[model samples]
Target: MRLPGPHWPSVAGRARADAGPLLLAALVVAVVTVLAAAIPPLLSATADAAVRDAVRRDGGDLQVHSRMEDDGGPSASRIRHPRLAESVDDFRARATEELGPGLRAAVHPPVATVISPTLKITDGSVLRTFQLAYLSREGGPAVTWITGGPPEPTGSETASVPYGAPPWPVQVGLSEADAAALQLRPGAEIPLADDQGNVKKVQVSGIFRPSDSADPAWRLAPALLKPVAGADGRGSTRFAGLLSRESLPDARLAFGPDELRRTAWFTPDPARLSWDVVPPVAAKVVALKAASGSSGARDGSLKWETRLDGVLRDVSAQVEAAFAQASLLLVTLLTVAALVLLLAADLLVRRRARPLAAARQRGMSLPVIGGELLLESAVTALLAAAVGLTLAAVITPGVALSGAGAPGPGAAGAVAPGAGLIGAGASGVSWEWIAPVVIVAVLAGPAFGTLTAARATRDRRVPANRSARRWMRDTARLRRAAAELGVLLAAIGAAVALHQRGTGGGVLPASAPALCALAGALMLARALPFGTRVALKRLLRSRRPLAVFGAARAAATSTRVLPLATLVTAAALTTYTLTLAAALGSDPSNALTLAPAPTLGAAVEGGPAAGPLAAGLLRLAWVVGVTLPVLGLLGLALGAAASAPERWQTLTRLRTLGLRSRETRWVAAGELLPPAMLAAVGGPLLGVLLAHLTFGSLSLHLLTGAGPAPAPPWWGIGAVAVAFVVAVAVVVPVEAAVRRRRRLSEVLRAGDG
Candidate 1:
């Protein structure tokens, strides 16, 4: 060119020529990136929904209850005079503050109350005891008066009165049911005497009913609304009457500092909760409980009780188990994706071998050539990853929509609004998984390119003696054996760790299946050559020329470890996915499988937490079912195509000896079929073995609600094997047909060149 300009036109032409491999590289990167980006949001949504459902089911049990009993001790008497109401308020505030911000924001305002010990009721002749309750108006339950208004305190602050003396009585409200059972009405006065013979009279100020009995305010003491039969077996009934907040100070005084029980209840608003806040909230609750019991508490006698921590702990455990299962499946998918990428890269290297060799012969530096390849690959991979991430974010809603009507309440665990590139939920997308996938995709191209270029450009001289060649072969064999042994040991260790630690083992357990597959693949690759050689020897003895040639060709082809590994792993994953789906679907109690009653269906049908898990598993199964076979076939095609040049030269020579094109295809089929058949047969068995090994440690019952993991589904495994074999059978002819189109003259000219 004029002025010796850069060969942009030639580079463009080369790029156009290699569009197939480049596009494939990009597509693989994009797909893996999309998968990586999509998984975290789905898991987050599922976990959040599960936590919400658990919180909802817990109902009032999740309310935090803090109470203190003061026996008129010197310490209690000191705090009683200045107004016990302030002390009660202080306790409520302290409990709220200790819950941490996340939970504090979720809690309903505390309902403070004062409770009196059992005292003899003098109004009724039954000699019963009445429990006095002073419910605060600020955060108390809404009540509708059936007869009279709420209670109000009298002006007197006397702690007690003489047993027979007339005294100012505390005014109290009672529920209609309680009023009827106690034979008392508004304005009726009941005299109660303590164990020490000190007396106090309480008049029924009102008869009322709670507006919502299920409200958290009423849950603090059910006895306040209804009479509780004493556990003494004497059939003694104790009735509780509610006094207004204004009477709380008087009630405290009348009961004496020693006999009063002051309490506060804080209920959480489920709407404000999500899975992400569970651990911290639970920890805070535990801390609050411990602080209440400790001497450092606001009141030395204060005691805190709440099952919220336990409820949240159960939710956390379930979420972790669900995540472990999901991670296991995702890791398998990623491993297979990695293998496919490597196979594609290997194909690309083979395609560029001739041009790369020519450049090296023309005095082009290896680094320069490698850098150019690296640049091209890096650009393609990056662009593909960007497109993939975009597509994942876009299609996430659609994927979620497809499972909208799934059985569980959490089944529609769609990504929350505002989820993007910032965080896990509304704020942004979580990049914990997405970043690694993108990095791998972007680097895969350059790494494979640079390495292949270096290998191709390295100078090599043929071994001069048979002993030298044997030594080299032995060295390579030993290296492969050591690598295989290492993978096997790693797999064993991962399995042990998974078994011991279960879901707590983190991502380490996820690698066991992949490592096991790698070890198996290495062994299969080692065995393939020996098997092919035996076939070749047997064919040579038979006088069938086409069979002999095909066998010889098959025996001569180098062992294809990458393609074999890809196919085996894909098959194993497919088998495992199908088996798991079958087991999950087989559950008789699974809402997904059950049909509603024909004519008398009940009004409410609740699904288990496992519902979302099963839905997710089925979705994953569908993906693995569709994806693995295609990738396996692609690997087979690439492996076959890598040998295209040599195959074409061989076919040309055979054709010169009058071998028919049909017979030449048989030779190609011979080379492809053995490995395909081996993978088809062995992969499912390996998958079943993997399932057996891992399911015991997986605790799948936590998600499936089934008894022990069922045996691997034989029918499904057989079907997967059949489908894989059929796919390879179909691919064989098509590949042979493509090779048949390569004219002998062109192949001959290319060989000469």
Candidate 2:
């Protein structure tokens, strides 16, 4: 029953030691990749569930409102409705008292509203405000009121514009974060205009992300379409009216034909579980709508028109989508680790060429050896997969899912092989995400390993001219050449695909294609051997020996740098493109600095002064320092990390050349001079860009003329310091590699062979 010639266990034991570093590196890269992709979605999921649970448990089902008045009261006409309100306090009290346990409602008055203003671009083009509904939050986050995970508010100013349109920044969403990021809370400067008030300037007090039904947001005068700063960077804000509380009514229905029966305007937090709405004249039909696709009224503006027991499908979809994305990323990561193991198996075959040749001489059949190879590959792949999955589970944190990360459950990107999901669509694991991805990854790993082993074994042959082949025509050269070509194509394709997706959206052409890039890199790196480093040595002569060697080795050798560099490149591109787009795409409020020529919602007492007066009340002391840098420290971190390696390598060579470690560090630090300068220019300039864009592209000086200057990213400069320490670490090995040469004994041995 002799089945296999070579023992599978022997192959595993021999290769395991060599695979350790690659495995560790793979683990790190995979973990980081999964985290960056998954955290945002995970955080969003947590918040969404929390909000839904809190709202439903609170017993607030429906809210009926018509409009707001100057004294923070509902418009007179709305008060006439059976369950309508004149004052929010009156409504909150009465609803909790009368409705008892069945319904719960609380209304907070805003100082002013920023009505959908006509949008005029800087290019002198006009954009219509046909669809208008702007959300502007003030003060602190509403999460403080509700005890939950990351509070996912329904809709604070989801955008600067009234309806969905081009955000002033080229491509980014509004900086709809919590209070610590935005810097204000409730009761400060809420808002300026209202359903009845006439005002321009508004204040911010609190933050909330209400659903799309907040028609009252448009009660304030249209804010100017100007450039604004945001949490990420500089972008333009459309109708960026500050979310101030009720100051005075902006307008009222004077004399419409429906006098006692006109349509009513109301604003409710969609994030709330249910709303208690009493239709005009207490009509039975009430509808609801949301931009995120919440449903109630099958009709327009009525996203949901169901009875008291709302379906909540729309809200749930958003949360589940994010959770699914995180989970998928986790699965893909584990799958990638398995692929790495398979790649390792291929390398193991190549490294064991001498041992295999001896086996062949000992009368081992090809099929028997091949079978052993396959079994070993499978075991290794599984082991790596298990370890990777465990790493992923351990590193996951309590993240607040951002809608940005939620591309709806599965990222619709690469699929994992052999993955499985439990349920789907609000109930179970998403089949589409888990099944295909895991299955493909699992099957592909072993198949790939076996195929590569078969091919290498079949192609195994001693060259007719062993001497010429060793230097020029052997399997090593041919294999190295093939690996280089394949990896080049795959990595380039990955880079290209990454560029396309990042510039646009989604992962790659498919999940498999993205993984191909990884496979290609591994294949190329392993196949190329260390010979390529010798070939590329000339390219490093201009730098210090250590740097030159590092560059030569990192560049020419496939295994040394390809995988990590490729990953670093992908991560850099992702972080950079998204950050830059977000920085350039995000916008701040123009109302933060400019006031609207507030006009009454209805016929009012004070005319022009009324608008200014209400606006004036909003400019409070606490409101003085609410700055949001569209491009903040996140940008700095990315920039520094991108350039750290090269700087460190240069310093290493100097240290190896007998310079003081400290001196070498400084020299290495000096290498960062260009990027450091870049960080300097980019940091303050980003601040300037943010302030100007957010406040209508105004000329700026921090703390003196315009406002406070952005604080320099001392941390980025500190990165240079860290780079110096790294240089010392790199110097030792780099010098050894550079000084590497075949000794006379080795050359004589080679000649004899």
lDDT of each: 0.66, 0.32
By summed lDDT, the worst window of 10 consecutive residues in model 1 runs over 415-424
Q: Give a tens-digit lDDT track for model 2, residues 1-753.
A: 844455757567655744643353334333333333333322433333333443334323343322222222233222112111124334334333432231233223232222333222222223311111222333322222221122112222221122222211110111234233323354333222323433322233334442332334333322212223331224433333222222111111111112111122222233532111211101222212222123332222212122232323322232232232233233334343333333333344444555666665566666655655555544544454445344433433332222122223232112211111211122212223333333433344335444544554475665688686676655666775686677567546644543343211233322322344344334433534444455356645554553554444334323443223233222222222222222221223323322432310111122221111112212210011110111112222223333333334444444455765555444433332322232333323332332222221111110012232333233432443344334334543443343335333443444311
Best-matching candidate per lDDT = 1
Cα-based TM-score, every candidate: 0.82, 0.36
**For candidate 2, what is the TM-score?**
0.36
RMSD of each: 6.9, 21.0
Question: For residues 380-400, could you state the per-residue lDDT of candidate 1 as single tens digits?
Answer: 777887787677667565333
- Any idea what lDDT model 2 has? 0.32
